[model samples]
Target: MLKINLQKKLQRFTLELDLEIKPAFTALFGPSGAGKTTSLNLLAGLTKPDSGKLSLKQKQFYSEKQKINIKPQQRNLGYIFQESRLFPHMTVKQNIEFGFQLLTPNSRKFSFDEIIETTGIVSLLERSPAALSGGEKQRVALARALLASPDYLLMDEPLASLDQPTRLSFLIFLKSIYQKFNLPILYVTHDIASVINFADEVLILKEGKIVGYDKPMRLLAQLQTRPLAAGEDITNIFKLEIIRQSKSRGITVVKSDKLEFVLPHLDLETGGELLLNIPASEIILGITEPNGLSASNILPGIIENIYHLQERVLVEVNAGEKFTVEIVEATVERLNLKKGTPVYLIIKASSFRRLS
Candidate 1:
């Protein structure tokens, strides 16, 4: 477990942090000048706080009252930044080994060879940083960090410079890292999609203070009014199991935890899982079963909660599977909707997209 309570005065606002983090992949998210990077610096011992306490299990990093502060190298933290930060003169193999050399003899959990194979950099070992692509350089950086045998990992927008394909590949690798090490990870990024797709818990910062922290969907719910820097709706991201697929009809059957759904099929294999994204604004709700409708996908569920927007309402439905639907306020009054009311949902096959 990791704990923090720190205070710092930035140029824009005063930074106050108090958080208890478990061993899970977490994202520190906020707009510009919200102090996400500063928090990471504090964790990595790259910056000192005016006053606070920090601890990781049996070890202590900072205790202002005690006048005890650990140095950066002594903190046993793996830091991956926005840039690759690889040595131009060194080959990929040398860059990674440089990190391994930082580890003390007693702290080496993984052998040097293990880090190389795990990160899939064996083929690039002989190549210099200049010869590698942007994505490849980042992978080398990540490999170096892992080899440090750190107790925790601090990543600051590590994928910001990569293209879509590279970013997805790196994300898959990130998930594997958690499963293999079970080390607490603090990921800082401004990309809403990256947080939604990767983070198990999200910490939302606003005006230099933590506004909210929870699982991705709930955190997004609490921060609904604050649009993502890019105005992306990071809602209703589901990992659904594919039950059956019909290539001829271009439809697939999938099962959520509670509800089974029929959706337009993509080129995905059956028996595997796929990421599905349904924007709240696209989900439609109806009071009664449709008498005649062009949309073939209709689900019956009960209203679990209702959130009022400026002119729209977000209706949360529990159909064994849960989902959020955005509808106009006038519809709410017409249907006399309230909690526990059974509502039918209409989802055009085109509305939901397959993420993976």
Candidate 2:
């Protein structure tokens, strides 16, 4: 476990944090200037706090009163910044070896070959930083961090620089790394979509204060009646098992713990999983069942809550698995939708997008 109780006085506001992170993927979610990066810096010993304590597995990393502060390299915490921050003078192989050489053989948890293979950067090892693309550079950086054999890893929007498709792919790759190594990670990002289907628990930060911490679904449920963040759409993301596929029907069937979804056909194996993203704006809600329609999926549920956005209203529906449906205020009033209003979600089979 990692414990942190730190206070820092920044120009905008004072950052006061009290958190206990377990050995799982925990996300620090917030908008710009929420002090998410500052919190990570404090934990990594890159910055000193005005007061408080920091410890990992009963080892003290910092103590303002005790005048104890561990050096950044000595903390055994790997830090991946927003940029790749690789050395222009070195090749990818040399850059990765820089971190590996810092530790003795006994301290290394993974071999250099293992890190390169796991990150899929073996081919790029001889390439220089200037020759690598955004995603490739991030992969090399990840390999460098893994070679350090750190107790915990800190990622600050490492995928933010990648394009949408590359970012989604990297997210899936990161999930596999977490599963394979079972290492603790504190991932920081402003995009809720990046963490919705990624993190085990989300720690919401607002103006240097910890606003909420819980499972992603439960945390969103608590914020159902209000906007979780400005200028961000609420999307329902799920990782479901592929129960079966119908090549004849051109459809695939997948199921969550409680609900089944019919999606457009994909050439994937049975029992494999797919990461699906259902945008709130793409879902249509109806107060009554309609007759013949072109849509393929319709789910019955009650209106759990309502949130009023600047232009559109977001409705929370409990259809076995909770779903967020977007609609306009005029439609909400026209359909007489409120808490406990029974409704059906109309979704086309092609509306589902595969993230991984």
Candidate 3:
């Protein structure tokens, strides 16, 4: 278990953390300046807290009262930042070996071949960092981190620079790494979509305080009742079974327990499952169904609840499954939508992204 009870006085707010983390995938989610990164820094020994205690598996990393502070190198943690931060002048292999070379033979846990093969960077070992793509550089960074054989992993928006598809692919690989290594991960991000199905537990931070902690769906359900932070994107995730496929029509039909929708052509077998992502902002709520529409997905349901943000509103509709839709205030008033009102959700086929 990883325990943290720390306080740091920043210029704008006093960061306070009181949490226990198990050996699983835990996400630290918040908007910008919410102190997500600060918390990671404190745990990694990069920043000192004003006062508190930090420990992992009963090993004391920091103790203000005891006057004990461990150096970053001695903490045995793998920290991956948004940037790959690889040495540009060195080859990928050399960069990855930099840390491993420092460790004595007794301290090494994984062989170089095993780490490179697991990270899928064996072929790119001889290439320089300048020659690697964004994904490739991140792969090398991950390989380098794994070579050190840290007790736990700290990721600070590691997938922020990648595109949506790349992010999805990298996350899939990260999940495999997590399962294979059995290492606890502290993933920090401002984007909720990245942690929907990936995080075992999510910690919501606001103004340098731990505001909420729960599973992804529970926290997301609770978040619908209040206003979201600035630039926060609420992404809905669903794993639906494939009903049929039409290659000539360029579409695939999928169904949940209560709703069936058409998505763009996916080269997957029928009856197999595919994970889908649809952002709240991408959905449009209609009072009634209309004809001659381009979008193929039109789900009808009753508005179970409504929340008013500053300029936008989030409406929860129960259409076989719960969906949180975002719309402007004017649209809500023009439609005269309220609790128990019937509404149609319109979504474009192109708006859906496959997670797996």
Candidate 4:
């Protein structure tokens, strides 16, 4: 278990965050300058709090009363920054071996060969950092961090510097590592997609203060209460089961308990389950069925709740246990919607964002 009750005042922002995280991967998510990095730095002992205590598994790393402040190097944290800070002059093998050399032979928690295989960088060992692709370099950097035998790993936007394809691949790789290692990870990212797929729990920060910390699905469902992106809409995740394939349209027909949707060319096998997101603003609600509609999908559900925003109304429609739809305000009144009102929801196939 990791517990933190820390307070620190910066020149412009005062940071106060109190959180207790279990032994699972927790993500720190927020906009830029929200102090996510600062929290991680404090945990790693790179930044000391003015007053408060930090502990892991009941061992006090920092306490104001005891005046116990551990140095950064002694904290046993493996930090991977946004950029892969590999020594350009050294080969990948040398870079990875550097940390292992610091540990006694008997005390090394991970073997060099295991680290290399875990990160899939065995072939790049002899090459210099300059010769590797962006993803390869980041993989080598991750391998180097794992070789350090740290108790916890901190990743600050590890895929931020990569291109779209590289980022996706790296994310898949990161997920595999998370499953295999069982190491406590404090991953920092501002990307909602990353948070949805990677985070076990999310910590929402706004201007150096914690606005909300909970499971990702819960936080995402109540996005209006949290500090979300300006003009950005909420995304509703749905559990979809592939029903059949439409070869002529090059799409896959997926079904939930209350709805059926056609998604573009998914590679999922029949009967496989997948997660998808539909933007709240993109959904349209209607009291009666319409004819000759261009929309490809429609579902019947009852309004579970309604929220009035400054400029929009957010409606939550329960579409069985597998799915929910969030529709905007103007349509709510235009359709004369009410709680428990059975309504037909329309969604375009293009609107569904597939989440792995």
Candidate 5:
């Protein structure tokens, strides 16, 4: 377990947060200048706090009252920044082994061969950082960090620089490592999609303070109340398994426990699982079925919660897990939507956004 109750004052902003993370992936999510990077620096011992306590399990890394502060090198943390930070002249293999050579004999935890295999960087070992592509360079950087045999890993928007396709692949790779190694990860990112698919718990930061910390879905449902970028809206993510394929239209039939949806032209094998994102504003709610409707999908669900905004009401429906639907105030009264009231959710086939 990792516990932090720290406070630090910077030139422009002050950082204050109290969070306890278990042996799982925890995400620090917020807008720019929200102090997510500063928190990571404090954990890595790259920045010193004015006062507070920090501990990992039984080890105390910092304590202002006790007058104890550990150096960055003494913390044994694997750090991966937005840039690869690889040596320009060194080959990939050399860069990875450089850290392994500095580990003490008794402290050596991971082997070079294991790191290479785990990160799938064997083919790029002979290539220099300059010869590698963006994704390949980041893979080598990950291998180097893992080779250090750290107790925890700190990732500060490592995929922020990659293109869309590369970023998607890297996110999947990161999830695999998190599941296989069970390493405590402190991931800092501003992307909500990344947080939804990867993070177990989310810590929302605003102007140097932690505004909220809870499970990803719960925190995401409250996004309207928080400050977000323009054109950024709430997303409802669902875990689905492919049931069949429509050969004519080249679409995949996906089903969750309680709802079914069709996605455009997928190559997934039968029974393969995937994540789907449905935008809240794209959903339509109706108390009774409309005649001659053109929508392809309709789901029956009950209203679990309703959140009133400036002009819209975000209604959470209890489907398989939970899905959100945005509706207007006039519709809310016309439908007589109340907690525990059953209604039909109409969604167009094109409304579903397929994510890995």
Candidate 6:
């Protein structure tokens, strides 16, 4: 478990953090200028907090009032930034062994061979960072971080640079790490797609304050009924069961209760369950059901709730699962969308993301 209550006077706003993170993986998520990175820095001992305490697993890492501030190196936190930050002069093998060599022989939690095998970097040990691809470098960096046997891994956008496929690949490895190892992880990422797929607990920050924190599903449910932080609407996650497939049209049909939707073809079993996201902004609503529409998904369901935003209205429709749709305010009045009013939703095949 990690407990932190930090406060610092930044140039613009006072950066504050008061969180008790017990999950193996906690995601620090928010808008670009929400001070997410600053919180990570404070946790990693990179910045000194004006006042508060930081501790993880009974380890008192920082305390401004008690006059205790552990150095970054002494904190034993394996920090992985957006870049690999591997040594250019040394070979991959040397770069990986750099941290392991610093630790006393008795403190080593994993052997060199174990890390090499676990990270699948045996073939690239003799090569340099220049010779490695972005994904390979990240793998090597992960191995190096693990070699130190850190209590927690501080990953700041470790997969931000990688493409979707590469991100998916590393996500598997990171998920394995989260499951196999006892170490905790504080992952800072802007990619909400990745967050919903991997994160257990999500911390929402606005300006410099901790706006929200909860299990991903619960937080998403909360957002469905109301806005999260700074009028930000959460994306919609649906657990759909693939009922059939069409090779000619290159699409798969999924069903949830009475509603049926079609999406781009995915390599998933027809009878199996798949998780996908439809961003709230992508949905188009209508009061009357129409035919001959290009949209692959058009289903009718009653509007359970409506949240009026600045210029838009977030309509929560029960089209099988709770589907949150963001539409213009005028459309609300135009359609006479009151609670319990029936409505239809039109979404394109491209709007759905198969993150699984």
lDDT per model vs. reference: 0.81, 0.87, 0.86, 0.78, 0.81, 0.81
Per residue, candidate 4 scores C-alpha lDDT tens digits across 1-356 of 88889999987799998888777778888888989888888998988899999988867889999999988877888999788899988999999998889888887888888889889899998999999988888899899989888888899888887764456556656766888887878889887554555578887888888887887656765566444555334556566799998677788999876667887878679999876777776887777776688888777778876766445556667766323445555666777888888877888888987765
Q: Which residue window of length 10 is worst by lDDT in model 3?
A: 224-233
Summing lDDT over every window of 10 consecutive residues in candidate 2, give the lowest-scoring window: 223-232
Question: Candidate 4, residue 227: CA error in Å?
Answer: 6.1
Tens digits of per-residue lDDT, candidate 6, 223-295, equal 5323344423446665579999987879999976666789888767889976676778898888889799988
Candidate 2 residue-wise lDDT at 266: 90
Question: lDDT value for candidate 5?
Answer: 0.81
Give me the overall lDDT of model 4: 0.78
Poorest stretch of ten by lDDT in candidate 1:
226-235
Off by over 4 Å in 4: 224-356
Global Cα lDDT for candidate 3: 0.86
- Compute each candidate's TM-score over C-alphas: 0.75, 0.76, 0.70, 0.69, 0.76, 0.67
In terms of TM-score, how similar is model 4 to the real structure?
Answer: 0.69
Candidate 5 lDDT by residue in tens digits, 1-356: 88899999977888887888787888888888989889999999899998999998888999999998999888888999888799988999899988888888678776777778888898999998999888888889888988888889899898888765467557767877888877778888898655565688888888998888877766765765643345556667666899999778767888988767877768778999886777888998887766678777777888987876646677888765677787888888887889898888888878987666
Ranked by TM-score, the better of candidates 1 and 3 is 1
- Clashing pairs for model 4 are 313-329
Residues 287-340 of candidate 1: C-alpha lDDT, one tens digit per residue? 889868877579899999886645656778987677778777898898999999
